[model samples]
Target: MNGSKISFLAFGELVVRQLTDFSNNAFAALILLIQDARTPMAVSSGGDDIMQSHES
Candidate 1:
């Protein structure tokens, strides 16, 4: 029970972060943002990187 609660909290934080990060992004650009939220963040990277890579 405690583990699930902790997981829920972490998920909520990620959601808030996502919302904030995508606030200025366009609706079209938001599609990928929403899709990425469905995946486990820790596993999103190969476990070596936590931040996304940008070319610009």
Candidate 2:
């Protein structure tokens, strides 16, 4: 391929790599968000369970 075509291909490759990295980071962030949400709920429910057992 000529110089311009090679450069265009390289640019396209860079864009694809960047998009892949972004998607991976976004997925990781989503997982962290889900874990964070679940942690609070789990802790609250556990605490409630303990409190109920103590009351009884």
lDDT of each: 0.71, 0.87
Clashing pairs in 2: none
List candidate 2 segments past 4 Å from native: 41-56
Model 2, residue 24: distance off in Å is 0.4
Which candidate has the highest lDDT of all? 2
In the range 1-56, model 1's lDDT, one tens digit per residue, is 99999999999999998997778576757777776666646445653253444322
Write down the lDDT that model 2 would get. Answer: 0.87
TM-score of each: 0.42, 0.69
The runs of at least 3 residues in candidate 1 whose Cα sits more than 4 Å from the true structure, single-residue gaps closed, are: 26-56
Cα lDDT tens digits for candidate 2, 1-56? 59999999999999999999999999999998888787764656787788789899
Q: What is every candidate's alpha-carbon RMSD to the true fold? A: 16.7, 5.0
Residue 37 shift from truth in candidate 2, angstroms:
0.7
